[model samples]
Target: MSIAINLLPPEYRPRRHQLSRRVIIALVAGGLVLLAYVAFLGEMALAARRVAWLEGQLALYAPGAQQAAASNTALGDWRQKERELEQLVQNGRRWGQMLKTINEALPADAWLTGLEEDEGKGELTLTGGSTSLGGIGDFLTNLQGTNLWSMVSLQEVKGNGQSLTFTLRAVFPGAPGDAGKAGTIERAVEGK
Candidate 1:
């Protein structure tokens, strides 16, 4: 080992400048904190832009959506009316067929004066005059035998020794429930 001695005065001695471990660690930590803060600000800006874009899209489509909703309701109403009209047409056909059946069942000595219908009760009233009582019996029998009527019964009979006036009630199945109007058919008496 060799001993060395410095003879320089204190004022003339060189000074050494160096960083400590704690100071270096503090500088690195501060730099990392600043980077994280910058990243956070960038994310906030992006989120604000996304929110504005969504609002714009909503405003663009709102008017058309309202119009479509209104049209959908109108279409629904039109479809309902169409269905009701179709039902009425079907009922008309049924009524025509029933009248044709009655005409075909008439006897040569009997004639119909008037025909009335009660749709709700599904009843038909026939007023007519027959040349003889036997003619009325035959008419009732014919109406009863047909598949169209559920039941047939004589309501009244009046005879003056020359001709007979009769009222017959017949029950028809599957009548319409909605009340609109009653159908009436009238004919002049055979000779009057």
Candidate 2:
């Protein structure tokens, strides 16, 4: 006699279906957020790798870059000094070959008390008791004829009737034989 069943309204039934759709939409949104987080982590990893690679490249080049900069500065300074020295030599004021030539022609018995070469000017002071006046005269005559010297003139002569002192001045002509040596020095200096 009491077996009747109570049923929901049609509107309530449709509300349940709507709730199902909302749950599915919420799940899909949550999945999208998780995927975005993973992608962001991957991007961070790639960015870190790029930074490390750039740092490594800098390390590899740092030493050589410093060395090249230092070398350039030193080379520039050396070049400037060489040019200045060349000008001084070319002005004919610094005769580098005068002293040796004079020494080569010195007599075995004659001893130089003062010998100097300065700015292409040569001065010599000699003291020796010659065996005879003829030997002293011959030495002076030979020095006057040498082409390596110019303005060969005697300065003063003093003798105590036995000992002799003589002073002379000459101009250094430089040596003709030193041309090849000069060129070699110039090349070696410029090679670096």
Candidate 3:
């Protein structure tokens, strides 16, 4: 059996070697809290690094992204202009052929006073006067037989004794190969 004895005075005595239960528990809790705080700081640092890296990558590709957007806009504009040009060319060709067919189909005693074309609607309106009703009928028949005209309608007819005034509207189908000869006449009219 071991026996310990203290020979010093009370003021010089050594303190107890064992800690209290509450002090030990408090120390353990403080250590756990410190560890959690350190872990949180490590996570924050890693997140900051990741964010900076992503921003750098985005910066590298930003110019190419802008260029691609501009190129797409330019391509769209070019396509729109191309479509408009095609529409204009189609209208010009159709008008040339339509005028030629109308000139050929008119009767000798029928003369056109006003002619109007709506390219967008594919419509042609003709206002004319004829010496006789038979002449107007012959002109209508001739127009109906032509390949250039469709949905030919005589809207109005006014008779003043020996003279007859008529209004007619027709739809022109944009045919493919019928514009060959009419193209020459168009060029002649344009003095080209």
Candidate 4:
């Protein structure tokens, strides 16, 4: 044991301290700053993981998204083709009916030598010979009476006294016209 004796006035005596209050406060503050920095680093790591997870999810769905887009485009194309096919079928039906009507309207004395049809223009040209001119006139009148023939014109008439050769050109109702004449015959036929 060591014994130290201070021989001084009571006011001049030195006091021994382990740590000052200011130093304790500064240490506590420094520890708190370090702890905060560690927490910030942890939070940044968590955010990075979350971002990586989200990117993986997006990548997983990317192929499915592309397939869905391609499916939509193919569906649209199929629908367009279906519409076009339906139109073609409808046109075929109309032409068949028109041909039947023309056959029915033909006169017994008249025989057709040539018949040509232009589907794009909806025009029909017929070259026929008839022993009687009256039969040709009757055929023309019968065609005109039908709503299917929008316009009928006599193209040529040439023959000897024995028989007559005539060429006739006619436009059907569904033909393209200034009046938008398509489907007129269909409507008229349905009405009848």
Best of the candidates, TM-score:
3
Work out the TM-score per prediction. Answer: 0.50, 0.42, 0.62, 0.49
Q: Give candidate 3 misplaced runs (Cα > 4 Å).
A: 1-14, 76-93, 116-123, 131-134, 159-164, 171-192
Between candidates 1 and 2, the one scoring higher on TM-score is 1
lDDT of 4 at 155: 68
Cα distance off (Å), candidate 1, residue 104 = 1.5
- What is candidate 2's local distance difference test score? 0.60
Screening candidate 3 with a backbone cut-off below 3 angstroms (N, C-alpha, C), the clashing residue pairs are none
| Per-residue accuracy of model 3 over 71-141 as CA lDDT, tens digit each | 99999999999999998886565667778888899989999999987766767789999998787777777
Clashes of each: 0, 0, 0, 0
Tell me the spans in candidate 1 whose CA falls farther than 4 Å from its real position: 1-74, 89-93, 174-192
lDDT string for model 2 (1-192, tens) is 899664877766545334577899999999999999999999999999999999999999999999999999999999999999898777644334655555555666554667655543333334434444454555555665666654355555666786566665554445333233423322432331
Q: Which ten residues in a row have the lowest lDDT in candidate 2?
A: 177-186
| lDDT for each candidate structure | 0.79, 0.60, 0.79, 0.79
Residue 101, model 4: Cα distance from true site in angstroms: 0.9
lDDT tens digits by residue: candidate 1, 1-192: 998876799788776677898999999999999999999999999999999999899899999999999999999999999999998887643767788888888899999999998877878899999998888888877887788866667777898888999998876656543232212111111222
Q: Give the Å shift of residue 132 in candidate 1.
A: 1.0
Model 2 earns a TM-score of: 0.42
